[model samples]
Target: MSNKKKERKLAKKLLHKYRLVILNEDTFEERFAIKLTRLNVFVLTSISAILLIILTTLLIAFTPLREYIPGYASTSLKRKANELNTKTDSLQKAMLMNERYLASIKSVLTGEVKTEDFNRDSILKAARQDIDFSQVLPNRQDSLLREKVDKEDKYNLFEDNNTANFVLFPPVNGAISEAYNLEEKHYAVDIVVPVDTPVKATADGTVIFAEWTMETGYVMIIEHSQELISVYKHNASLTKTQGDLVKAGEVIAMAGNSGQFSTGPHLHFELWSKGYPVNPTNFIDFE
Candidate 1:
């Protein structure tokens, strides 16, 4: 037979009708009946399978249940994991540095090392190291990259190119107990939040400083751009460190009465433009 004829024959066989009937078991009478075909059944099953697959895919891709799947993690989850790992590594380094400092203190207390009349020549010789004075020539690719970076950095907050339109996140949710007073040398505003309240970043930036000082206590400062900097002072503890990038509204510290100047728990938030302090209340509304 010809190919066309063969296909027609097979199609006819598939289209063959079948009877699906429910017979009364006691009386042998047909209680119900429906007409069905092989082709019809096959098509129905295929469509049902396709619908099931579509629903399953949508559920996994669009819902939080996707996290339950092995080897699958959302973009935000991955980023958080990386941030935590970086924090862990930084803490390890800090611990090692602290250990070295403690060891030096112990040595001084025990007289294991001489405090004075040390050998200046030995110190100078130990400090001496070989220097690589080879000049590095800039390639075409490097020059192009440098130019691109410089061009992008030119329109920063310092130049007032775009920051005036940017909205800032409130560092804390509280009442402003103290306003910015430049005449009184009070450059920052004091927000009165309950103790242990989180202090958040006002913009996306890298932490430039996170340390304890006698005046500020546990202070954290973030550098947003060439001209913009946000400082959170009198914190109980800092969650970020120098060089760590933080997003707007991300918690960077906890509010507390840490410094000698602080009488109660609060967040002393300061915004700096260029070398001068700006009124944070102008951009952020604590109330």
Candidate 2:
């Protein structure tokens, strides 16, 4: 056999051994090859899909994505919030009272009102006649009588009599901002002092009043012999109480800006004998 023919036959045998074949027919033939098992592919695809779903769920549940969900408010939490609000409101009111008391003190010291005629009730009545409740009381006779007696007694004790011997310092060392007068209806002397200064008793007396007031803040009223009464107003705090005996120059209170009519730290000192307002400066030597 010829060498070329032998080589051609050997090549054809090698192609047949490897299952490589060429068709001579003119018709097309369909061919298919399997790469993987159907069951295996399906199982892997299902597992991947499940893992994606789980990851997405975890992100939504544990991350900021959860914020999209509306959270329900608890009644207990709401109640607590309301209570806090109420407390805050009360504190604010107290602060406002302190501010006003201080302002009133400043006004008195600056001569806004006459010390001799400064009547807190009368001023309130005149300025707020529309809101006056004095006339609406069930039994105003007692109130009127008491007021009248108080005024008369104060006037007589300070003006008509000279019974008390103990002199007093009108206020702690501070400028006399306001003086006593009767024409303008101012009935007290105002002394401007630093906040928290000590307020001393003008004379030996028993404390008749020591309490927080809307207009005067913390007030201390002392009654001495011969119907003499001294009023200390707008105290930040009181060291003495009602019925407590206090001596002249004794520390009775700490100066404060507490009251509804005060503007700053000061002592609104008033002297009364019998029942009327008296000039505190007359008895106190500021120099």
Candidate 3:
């Protein structure tokens, strides 16, 4: 019974009303008045606080004003960062490709490439499959001319030219002082010429090496198309340098007895095809 009485007392206090008034101080006249219960005031205050918290959360989550907060990245900054990442990737790929290209060039220059004998007959046979052989008949003169051409081309190495628009130019007009002898390990032909004779490029190519060596003296190496490389040694001086572009018959060096192995003024010319040394007389007439 005592507990019930205490509970009733507490409820009465919670529901008790209070009068609030606004007054004219001098006249003591009531201008405004309101009656509010304790429970009503508490409920209204709690509701207002919750509403204010929800509004603050919404502003921060949905508006750009959230950028003012710490540890938040701006939208523009994120976009720029992504763009820079893409550019970096592209630059890396380009750099890798350039490196590979340079490696291939270096291998060719250093004679480190593997040798492969290209089968011209097989390639020509495959290419001839598309040709129409019954286009026309040849006259008696044409047959004679064809026979003459066939005889002339029988021993010519480059007669069935594989590379398009490719032709070799003789480096110099001189007699062969020392012919290429594979049995004696002599891989180059010694062309006997007067000192300071101009050595011309054999084909359109880029100069990859132009320098002096103890055994070969001043040497110039040119890289031509169709896996052909020409080397000129025992030079008095070089007219072209590395990385230079030269056309066929362009003067590249001067012939002289400049090396330790040279016996007289001459040009030591070497031809390499697909990393293997080839006889220059096969493709060029040095009579």
Clashes (backbone N, CA, C under 3 Å), per candidate, total: 0, 35, 0
**Cα lDDT tens digits for candidate 2, 1-287:** 69999998775654442323454457645354334444456677999999999999999777766656679455566899999999999999999997886675454433354335467898877878666678766477888998887876652334444644446655587887777767766688788899999999888899877888787798888888777778888899999988799888899999989988997888888877665567877567654
Ranking by TM-score: 3, 1, 2
Model 3: per-residue lDDT, tens digit, 1-287? 99999999888988998999999999999999999888899999999999999999999999998989999889987999999999999999999998987686555334354546899999999877877667757889999999998987764544336764577899998899999876665667888999999999999999988888777688888998877888888999999989999999999998899878889999888888776777898888876
TM per candidate: 0.45, 0.44, 0.49
Q: How many clashing residue pairs are found in candidate 1?
A: 0
- The lDDT, on a scale of 0 to 1, for candidate 2 is 0.75
- Determine which window of 10 residues in candidate 3 has minimal summed lDDT: 106-115
Model 3 spans > 4 angstroms off = 1-165
Candidate with better TM-score, 1 vs 2? 1
Tell me how far the alpha carbon of residue 94 in candidate 3 is from the true structure, in angstroms, after superposition.
13
Q: Candidates ranked by lDDT, best first?
A: 3, 1, 2
lDDT of 1 at 151: 84
Once all C-alphas are superposed, what RMSD does model 2 give against the true structure?
A: 17.3
Off by over 4 Å in 1: 1-159
**Candidates' lDDT values, in order?**
0.80, 0.75, 0.84
RMSD of each: 20.2, 17.3, 11.4
Model 1, TM vs. native: 0.45
Q: What digit string (tens of lDDT, one per residue) describes model 1 on residues 1-287?
A: 69999999898889888999999999999999999999899999999999999999999999999999999868999899999999999999999998986575333222243325789987877655343325556789999999997887654344555665566889898888889986676778899989899889998999877888786689887878655878788999988997899999999998899978887999888877764667887667798
